[model samples]
Target chain A: MSEILLQIDGREVEARKGMTILEAAQSAGIFIPTLCHHEKLEAYGACRICTVEVEARGRKNLVAACVYPVEQNLVVRTRSEKIDRIRKMILELLLAHAPDAFALQDLAKEYGADKDRFEKEASFCIHCGLCVRYCAEVKKKNAVGFVDRGTRREISFIPEIASKECWNCKECFPLCPTEALQAAFVLTKALFSP
Target chain B: MPRINSATELEELRKGILSKRDPNKPCIAICAGTGCLALGNDRVISAFEEEVKKQTLEAKVDIRATGCHGFCEKGPNIIIYPEEICYIEVTPEDVPEIVSQTVLGKEVIDRLIYTDPNTGEKAAHQSEIPFYKNQMRHLIGNNSKIDPKSIDEYLALGGYSALSKSLFEMSPEQVLEEIKKANLRGRGGGGFPAGLKWETARNAPGEEKYVIVNGHEGEPGAFMDRALFTGNPHSVLEGLIIGAYAIGSHQGFIYTRHDSPQLRNNIAVALTQAEEYGLLGENILGSGFNFNVEVHLDIGIFVSGESSALMRSIEGKNPEPRPKYIRTSVSGIWEKPSNLNNVETWANVPQIINRGSEWYTSIGTERSKGTKLISLSGNIVNTGVVEVPFGTTLREIVYDIGGGIPNGKKLKAVHFGGPMGGSIPESLLDTPLDFDELAKLGAPIGAGGMFVLDEDTNMVDVTRFFLNFLTNESCGKCVPCREGIRQMLKIVTNISEGKGREGDIELLEEISEVAGAASLCALGKTASDPLLSTLRYFRDEYEANIKEKKCRA
Candidate 1:
């Protein structure tokens, strides 16, 4: 792999080819908050908490750091007023679903986001896909996956597979950013178990 | 029919097909497009057949059910060849008179002809009609002439000659150069240069590449793609083969709506016929080049029309979009390079190759070349598919071609690009139809869905309605789009229902900014375009709804 150099938060950082901005930031010990991203899986880019402003070839654009690959002479701003506003709004939106998620609460405090900024539905799954990706990518079990789409999208455990595999494993239970995954697993257990 | 093995053989086949057709034969061409079919043109067609048989004029008088005639408001339309007399809204009762008088006696019917609602003038010929007169129909002009299922008819009309020329005469580089020279832009919303995209996929370091025809006309008011694709499937197929040859790809995919069976059936028939005639498949035209096409149906969501999502769907995965940090032409469709163009965009390729780039460039503006197919709808008198060259004024399209707003209502605005696009007020009616010109007014002519809104339409409610559509159609993969649209829809719905607060507009703008900036794909990035443009021009209505709690509309 070839070495690529870029600037993040006014500090020069060196990265390898095919390395993502979030990866490079992490290698250089730079702090960029994330929700749906995990090193063990492919970049999902669902949470969008790691969205950073990038300037390249005299063009500025907002891109997800976890997915956008690093390039030489690229300028990345990990924190900006616009990015802060976006993160704050994203947290507030996610709060409507899972207001008590500790990850969201931490970010909400940091971004000065009001938990009650929007009305609450409280389905409680932030749709981070951590459990889904962990089950599929790391475990190779395919026990949990996403269902439906858009705002109605949620994680569901395969009853047949969960019955065969998850009862003994239960490894993905702790990866949920909110209580919705556990609730879903409990509902599946109660509904499908003989 | 045997597959032609060489360019000379292809020409011989064309000659054979044309020689079989008589120029002086009296042919009654009935429009069988979806619009006309919905208006009972199929019944009219059977009526013509029965009349021809009952009058014992079956051998002498020919009844041909062709494609869309473009004058959908006045369908089921019929045109008699040799004399070329046009008739509109013909019923089964009038088919006997049409067969006797127009087909045999050469007498034109006055009641069935197109009469100008304003001038009380009658137009007997299709060319003289006010709607068809002011427009240029380069792409869809042949829709009324040829049966979509017949490969011989397509060959008779000089269809695959462009493919023959590309295969026998020009190299792939030369073909790419000609398309680049023509400056052909994609008609599927973005207006991105198709030539540049082809060059990218061609130059990309992958031997295995794919070309796709994006026939998914998911935009609410856009049905012109269906009209052209269904009416002239061979033209689009020929264009796709030519594009595939240029891009050095053997496989092509036609991604279309699953709802339209006619369009799908027409395409399937065209593919089989083309393959049978050696216009497609192995060593096409015996030029030692191989190409084939597969048809993929979308799962019926607006977001599936997005390039990445469409590619994912083609791969049999969930139809969710990924960010285009890398262009699809560089890495797409199982990470192999892919070049996708809209059905209308592909249909223009054969014409460019046949007529050359200079002749193609002679039609439209400096930047936007050739004619565009606009599905004129929403409060307009003539709600149908219209084809006109670029640089035609919006005023001409509305008044002359569209026949203006109905019921004597005043014109308020014209919306373009559906949810991802914006609306322009009547003050900007003088704006030309150039891609950049319409985009400059914040309403990109996306897939050419033109919605003319009358004075009674409320802009706030319109914006809210689009937001609601995006909310349902959003892939929900990313936070900003799924949540931002949900929240924005909530606020806009409240505003539309006269429950708007003072800071609601500012809050909507703030959320729109976040959604526009931080969203995953173009669907999320442009999700706020309708709201922003409505706010730009119609802020007063939002203010009135919020401050005074009343809708002025």
Candidate 2:
């Protein structure tokens, strides 16, 4: 791979041409927050928490650090006023879904995000797709998957697959940012068990 | 009929078709478009057929059920040939008199012609009608001339000549160059240059490239794509085939909506007819350039209209849009170079090739070239598909062609692009229909869905209505769009219900910035456009609902 030279938060970093800004920052030990991204699996740019300011070829844009590929002489800002506001609003919005999600609460404290900035929906699932991708990509079980679309989208454990494989391999349980995954798995087990 | 083998044979076939048709034949062209069909043009069509047979004038007076005539408000519409006499709101009972007086006697019917409601002036001929007169009709003008299902009629109208010209006369590079010089921007939305996109797909390192026709006209008020595709399917197919040749693609896909059986049937028939005529498939017109096409139907969602999502749907996967940091032209549909354009954009390709770039550039404005097919709906007096050059002003479309607003209600705002687009207030009605011009006024001419709102229409309710639609249609892949729209909808709904707080507008703007900037795809990015544009022009209405608990509409 050709070596790519770029800057992250004003610090010089060396990355490969195919590397994403998140991967480059991680290699250089720079801090960036993420919710739906995992190193073992492909980048799912669902949660916009890692949205960073990027400038290349005299054009500046806000892109998810996980999916935006690194370029030669690219400038990336991990934190900015605009980015922080986006992250803060994201935290507040996600909080409405899962009010007690510990990961969100930690970010909420840091970003000064209100727990009830909007109406409380409390669906308990933020639709991170972590459990789904983990089951499908890492474990190769395909036990959990996304169901429906848009605001009603949620992760559901497939009863046919989960009942057979998820009994011993609770691998996706801890990956959930909230209790929704475990709750879903338990519900599926109870509903499908003979 | 045997398959045409060469340009000479194609020309011979065209001549053979033309020789059989007489220019002065008294053909009763009935409007059987979706609008007219809904208004019971099918009964009228059957009535005309029976009347012609009963009168034993079937051979002399030809009854052709053509496509949309554009004056939808007055449909079931018909235009008699030779004299070009126009009739509106035709019924089954009127079919007999139409056949006798108009077709047989060549006498114009006084009561059936278009009478302007505002001016009380009568227009007997189709050209005299203000709606048809104002339009340039470069694309949809043929709807009233030819029957959609008849390949012979299309050939008589100079259909596949563009394809023949491109294959026999011009090289692919020359074809691409002409399109580039013509500056034909995408009519679907975004107004991106079609030539540049084709060049990128052509240059992308790949042996297999694909082109797609986005027939998924999911915009609520937009039906022009359907009118053009269904009425003149061959025109769009011819354009798609020519585009495939120019882009050096062996395969192309037509992705249309699963609804509208007429549209799907017309496209299916068009494809089969083109293949049989050797205008498509292997060794098209015996030019040794092999290409084929397949028709795919969307699973029925607005998001499926997004280029990436449409490509994904074609791949038999869930139709979700990917971040287009890398253009789809470089990597799409199983990682092959793919060029996707809307149905209207593809339909314009054949015209650019048939007419030289200079002739094509003679019309429209500085950047935008050629005519745009706009579907006018809502409070307008005339709700139908209109085709006008790009430089035409909104006032011309609204006042002249649209016949102004109905019920003498004052015009409020004209919303373009459906749920994903913005609106322009009455003050900006003079803004040209050019892509950049309307975009500058915060209302992009997206797929050309012009919805007129009257004085009684509340802008806040309208914004909320569009948001509610998006909230259900959103694919929920990203946080900024799904959750952000949820919160924004909550605020807007509350504001519309007179429960908005003092800082709700600022909060909505802040969320719009984040959603607009941080979202992964175009759906999320443009989801807030309606709210932002309404807030831009009609802030006082929102303020009135919030501060005084009253609606200003």
Candidate 3:
């Protein structure tokens, strides 16, 4: 395979053609923050934590690096003041919604997000579509999917399919960044068994 | 009925159909559109049928239930042909008088005619009405002319002549070149050029390409698509078949609102009839161009109206927006080249072909070509759909065409584009309705929804209302959209209810910056539009709520 070239954080790096900006940055010893990406699954671009300013197609757009493909003459700024401010605001939003999520708490502190700025809604499950994708892709069980839309959107386990197909050891439970998934599973299970 | 082998056969069929129909006979066109149906047009329809059958004048008189007349504020409407007398707010009890006096005896009823609220003068003809006179209805004007269930009515009015012209008269590249020259832009909020979008899919490397009609007009205070689909479903179909031929796509889909059963049924019947006549299926009109269309109702969510999210819904997945690094036109719907145009945009193609691009381009502004269908609603006198040229000022739209605000209320502001759009103050009402011009003034023209706000309406409450709507429909896929919209909704709601703080505006601006840049799709990116525009123009309302803990109203 031929190696492609792209500029990331003022450093010249060689990458494969199909590699995402996050993957290319990682290969060049750079760390870009992310919440919904996993090497084992497809790029979802849901969390938007790993956003970077990219100039493509004659326009400068702040795009999620986890799903943006590398192309020729692609100029990427992985870390900038504008990027930091946007990432901090997104992290601050997450902290207000899911304050107890451990990964989110760590990232919020790293990005200097003020958790107290926004009123606490007392809810979990930021709906990153991680566990949903894990169940559908890796486990091949198709037991979980997203239900509803917007803030009302939640991860719902298909009880009929979960009971029939997802009988193996619960491998996707640990993949969740928040404890909301565990609580959801219990609630869904209770509804089905009762 | 055999398939039309050539364009000559199609023209012959049109001549035969037109020869059998009488132009002098009087017909009763009663509006059966959704709004009219809600207003008891069903009873009026049945009453007309019973009275006509009872009097045994069925041969002498024709009664057809048509679509919207664009005067929904005055519907259960009845219009008599040849004389062109229009009667509004008609009930079943008034049908006997109408059938005998108007249809049988050629007389007009005095009380049933629409009395202008301004001049107090009664107008009986559809052409003389204030709402229909000042405005140019190029697109929506067809609704009052045809019955949606009968293809013969559509056929007689030169419906599929454009499709026949596309297959026989022009090459695929020439058909595309004309649309590009006409500068027809997408009416589906995005406003991307339809010709350029089609060119990308047509040139993309793929053996299979798809065309989609986005009938999912979910924007609030907007029902023009519903009116068009329920009124003239074949215009959209003919445009779609012409587009598929131009883009070299075989399969097409019309994604519409699930709640619109009438729209879905009309489209289904149109598709079936077009197929039975060998106009839609393989070897269409014996031109060897095969195309098929299917109707897909949305799962019923606002985010499902997004192009990428809509594609995901059609693919049997949850309607969540994916990254648009790959344009849906280049790689969409099973990673194939897909061309998606809004309902009104597709409906314009047949007209552009039938009348020539130069004639079509001679209508709207220099940049924004052709007329736009606007649903004139909210605080207006004559509330219905109005189609005007692109450069028509907001003041003209609100005053001359809309009959000004009702109840003598002061026009405070005009909101366009629904939740994702911004509000402009009344002072800037003279701004021309151009795509780029509207975006320049904090308020962008989105999907042609013109909502007039009067003086009594609270700015903070309106901002909160739009933000709350975006929160319920955000799809929760991206962090900035889901979380950012939630935070903004909280602050805006606080300000509305007299619980605002000093730093709320700054915080909202900060969140707007993040959400606008980092959100996955247009829904999240522009979720802060209503809030930001309100803050820019109505900062006094926000400051009063924040500093004094009281609403200005």
Candidate 4:
């Protein structure tokens, strides 16, 4: 791939064409925080923690670094007051759902988010989509998926398919950011796997 | 019956249809729109038919079910031809009197006429009525003339002539130039210029581009698009074909409300009929340009109206809006350029082409050209869809067309737009309905739903209602919008319930700014608009809720 020159946090970086801002920042040795993003999978912009101000062609707005591909003459700011505030707010919300997830707690502490600003939601999944993606994309089981939508959206297991296809495959267990899926994987393995 | 091969054959068909219609024939046009249908207009229709047969006036008189006549407050309504006499709240029992007296005896029915509140005078004619007067009904007025089910009725009113003109006469480039010169902004909330979006999609790379007609009018109290789509769907379809021709898109989609089966069916029939006549699909009217359209229903959420999310929904994915860094107009729906416009914006296309761009530009304000369809609802004497020019003041709409606030109550404020919109206090009622002017006053003409609030209405409560609506409707994929709206809703609810803290408003503002700036899509970015605008204008109400623990009248 041909390399394109771009600026990240006032420093120059050469990134291959079709490389995302997050990837470019990583290659340039600049640290940028991310959630709902995995190197082995496609960019899932669900968590929105890697938001950065990107300016290109006289236009600028906040974009998810994971999904936004780097281009020639592109300028990106990885951190700012607006960026931090958004990240903090997102963490504050995330903590309400998966408050005990150690990575989320550390991220929250780094961003200095308030703990009780929002009410807690009832789920441990936190909607990272890592497990869902791993199960669907890598494992090729198609056993777990997101159902419903909006605030009520939750990751639901199709028991009929999971019972048939997921007994031996513990592949999605190690990929989850939270340990919510480990017990289910063990239960499926113990009950169904010969 | 065969596919029309040339514009000449299309015109000849239109001529044949028009020549067969008798102008002097006495016809009864009954509204079968959703609003009228709810009031059992179908029964009224059957009653009229039965009464007409009983009276032996079947051959001489024609009773046809038309679309919404716009004055939905006084339905089920009927407009008689040859004199344009309007009858309101028509019932099956009244059908005999209407047929015997109004149609046969050539006399007026005083009890059925709409009485003017101010003058204490009754109006029988459609044009003379205050609700229909003092306004420009360019797009919606056609609903009263044609049956939405019949293409013949639409043709008799000179419908596809605009398409014929655009396809046979003007080049695609010329059509784009006219739309650009007309400065027709999207009637969708953002008010972005329609021509600029079309030009972007037309010029964007990739041979396959898609044009979308957003019929998901899920905005609270906004049934204008639904009326337009359900009443005269062919107008919207004809407009879509013209837009596709201009944008060089062979494929199009009309995404409408999934709950409205009538709307879905009407559009389905329109598409089938249009295709049958060679108006759509494979070399439309022998112009060597081909276009085809499909109808898709929405996921039934308010946020699905966002362009990006709607595109995702059409792609058979969850209707969650992603950050539009690529700007959906250029790269949307399977990563191809897709040009999407609101139902009203597309409906205005035919009018712009039929009348020159100069003619279209002559109406409305300097910046926002063309007349807008405003759905007048909430605490008003007349709650229905009304079409008026852009520069018309809120005062005129509230007092004249809306028939003033109900039950002699003092005017409190007017809420424009829907959940993502703001309210205009009665003190600023003279604010014109122009896009820039209303936006300058902190109110945007979102979906053109003009909800009038009165003395008893609580401003804080109004804002709280909208926030709660958005909180539920949000896709929850993004953090700021999902949590920020939830937090704002909590604060607003606390303040409304008299348990608010001292720093609650400041906290709300901080969250608003973050959510408005950082959120992934338009739903997240503008999620705080209703709360912010209310705080800007009605700060005293919030303070009262916090300090005094009481609501202000």
Residue-pair clashes per candidate, as listed?
2, 2, 1, 0
- For candidate 1, what is the lDDT? 0.91
**Tens digits of lDDT, candidate 2, B109-201:** 899999999789999987889988999998899999989998889999899999999999999999999999999898888899999999999
Candidate 2 lDDT tens digits, A1-194:
89999999999999998899999999999989999988899998989899999999999999999999999999999998888999999999999888999999999998999999877887788888888898889999887788788888877777777778876888777788867465555547545772
Runs off by more than 4 Å, candidate 4: A119-122, A180-194
* DockQ comparisons of all candidates to the true complex: 0.83, 0.88, 0.87, 0.59
Scored by CA lDDT, what does every candidate get?
0.91, 0.91, 0.88, 0.87
Point out the higher-scoring one by lDDT: 3 or 4: 3
Best by DockQ: 2
Error of 3 at A6 (Å): 0.5
**Residue-wise C-alpha lDDT for candidate 1, range A1-194, written one tens digit per residue:** 89999999999999999999999999999999999988888998988999999999999989999999999999999999989999999999999988899989999999999999999988888888888889888899988788888777777777777778876777777777876466555537644772
Sort order, lDDT high to low: 1, 2, 3, 4
What fraction of the reference interface contacts is present in each model, in order? 0.85, 0.94, 1.00, 0.58
Give the number of the best model, judged by lDDT: 1
The ten-residue window of minimal lDDT in model 3 chain A covers A182-191
**Candidate 2 docking quality: incorrect, acceptable, medium or high:** high
lDDT by residue for model 4 (B56-135), tens: 98889998898889899999989999889999999988989999898888899999999998899899998789999877
